[model samples]
Target: MTSQTLLSHVASILDAAGVKRGAIHDVHTNTHLLRHEVTTNLDATVYRPLFCLILQGAKEVGTSAKLLKVRAGQSLIVSHALPVVSRITEASPDRPYIALVFPLDLDLLRSLAPAVMPTFDKAASDPFSIFRRDMDEGLEDALLRYFVQCKAKNTRHLLAPITAREIHARLLIGRHADVLLRLLWHDSAASRINEATREIQSNLSETIVVGDLAQRIGMSSSAFFEQFKAITGTSPLQYQKDLRLLRARDALRATRAKVSDIALRVGYESSAQFSREYSRKFGKSPRQDRNIAPVEQQQCIADPAPR
Candidate 1:
């Protein structure tokens, strides 16, 4: 089927299931279905590696430095964890915004790397960990079949994995091939920066010394600083700061922990400073109710909603 036809089918699936607003997790496929009925204000969250396919409407997703507009029939690939702000740019009761969110398994992508033909792509010159492009027919078809598989209890576990593998394999050979290929290559700068990101995420509250991270990743301070920003689109220190505030925001919404304690948990020794930063990021006080915050795993800060 054409991409348009597949998108409409996916829309029908979500509409019939009554997911006309916000997001719902798909237990079987381990993905999230997102929908919105109207345009929205900016929402912030940290995005992990995932695939997001927009079936209807459009959105504006941005990090500190990059802003991308994605619409229906386009797919977005987030290759690393990054904090982002986003707004739904187009939606209405008659034609809502709809999309699918599937987490990407870097290890699985790594395991499949050796099977592909190699190429020379400069990871340093590549400035983004998030990419958006048209959803090709093959990928859309595989995704549609994967959704269909999830509908049958028997095929959910059995055939879904096979189709999931097929989808990743298709991504490996698709337009995203270069960036994905670079990130998976063991000694590439993209891989090294990927390592750095994991270390930062592992301890968001802990103080990060860029020099130490550079040494740990086998690059000098200057080289690491430049390449890390090149690949991830933000400085190392800023990346850690953004992630810390995002995690703290999640804690604020999900728990009754005191705001000061949440700040300490995310590595801030000064509660006042943490509160100030949180307000700047989310445009609300740390103590405010986060009824509008996106769900934890939905991580679709990229797919926003009206609030």
Candidate 2:
């Protein structure tokens, strides 16, 4: 099928699914729909390993130095958990920005790795986690079939998983195959950084020792620090800080806990320090942010899926 035709099918599925003007979680596991009627300010969030296909409109996603514009007929693959700022760049009430996201299943990818034909030489340097490429007919067709099965009542359960696997297989052999392959290899930079991030996430409430983490990942401190920053666009400490603040924000919105209690819960020794950094990262103090309804604040941040 052509790119335009594939997009049409996806747009139809999104309309039938009835996603709202913001991010909506789909019934299928690890799938989400994003829609917006107007352009939005840059919103910070941790984009986990996922594939994002834009069916209509466009979006800009970036970190400190890297920015990617993903438009209709294009796809973006994020192979690791990275914090990014993203915004809808084009949209209208009549034709809203529409996109679909599916979190990558690493185990499934690994299971299919041996069967994948090697199509590229190993790169001397690791590529960034985020990749944008033209949507191929094979990938597009797989995505269309996935969405079609998603809408079907009786066939969805059996067919969706099969289609999801095909989509992954297509990506495994696509343009960013090397990056995805490196992520699966034990000694590759992407794999090591991914492991480190998971360790930090698992112990967010405790102190993180960069040297120890590097040692655990089988790299010198300097090497690990450099590669981690290169892949994630932030230092390890800064990444952990971002996660802590995000968790605190979620806590403030979800519970009646005091700001100080939340701060301590997320490993901040000083509540004053927490409030200062929280305001710097998010635009308002914790109390002020929490006063706003959860739905209103939801669009400003990205929630990382549990490891």
Candidate 3:
């Protein structure tokens, strides 16, 4: 088959297999977005650590101040947790937007780095933050085949990790290596900020002391705040709040618990406060919006227009 024909086949395989919209998969293959245009606004529960490949159409993702646009053949990567506003900018009835998200694995990056030639610029080091790029045909083909393999249970057991490695290798040589390479550097701000981010992500309900996290990452309060913003595109406090809101969203959908209880569980001292923030973040109160939308919609919200 021709290359374009192969890509089309891969897209078909993925759409035929996975959940329609917002669904989760195992470590191997998690989510897929079939070609479609959406008009509604939505929020997601889980903050996906993945890359979004847009086969067609356009999307916009926004945070408090940052708005990014992703167009056809391009993709956006969100490296950190964020409260976002996303809107579909391009789609039609005939040719809906086709997108795929590949989850990132820190462990895999560490494992594969030794085998690949280092092509990073140490002097231009920056923290691994969110990134955007246009995918080449080869990378797109690899991703399509990876998803197709993932759809087959038998093949996924053996090929998922291998295909995942190929994806990462392509990323290293693709347009946004600096952001990811910085994520792995020991002394880079991105690495420290990511380390701090992990601590907050795991402890979303706790009252985080940015100073303590700064100390843990060996950065002073001032330096830590600056580095954190540099890597994550937002302040540490905002990051914590975003994590709490996301967990609260999960709680909203997964259980029959009260909204107040869910809010408190996600670190809100007052239900009223949580509702207000949730409304601001999602454009609707937590009580008003009960269901989680597709993962793509939720993820793209943080970046509204693709950058």
Q: Which candidate leads the pack in TM-score?
A: 1
* Tens-place lDDT digits, model 1, residues 29-60: 77777788899877777777788888889998
Q: Largest lDDT belongs to which candidate?
A: 1
Model 3 TM-score, 2 decimals: 0.82
Q: Which ten residues in a row have the lowest lDDT in candidate 2?
A: 294-303
TM-score for each predicted model, relative to the true structure: 0.91, 0.91, 0.82
Clashing residue pairs, backbone N/CA/C < 3 A, model 1: 205-266, 205-267
lDDT of each: 0.79, 0.79, 0.66
The global Cα lDDT (0 to 1) of model 2 is: 0.79
What global local distance difference test value does model 1 have?
0.79
Total residue pair clashes for candidate 3 = 17
Which regions in candidate 1 have their CA more than 4 angstroms from the true location? 123-125, 289-297, 301-307
Order the candidates by lDDT, highest first — what do you get? 1, 2, 3
Backbone clashes for every candidate come to: 2, 0, 17
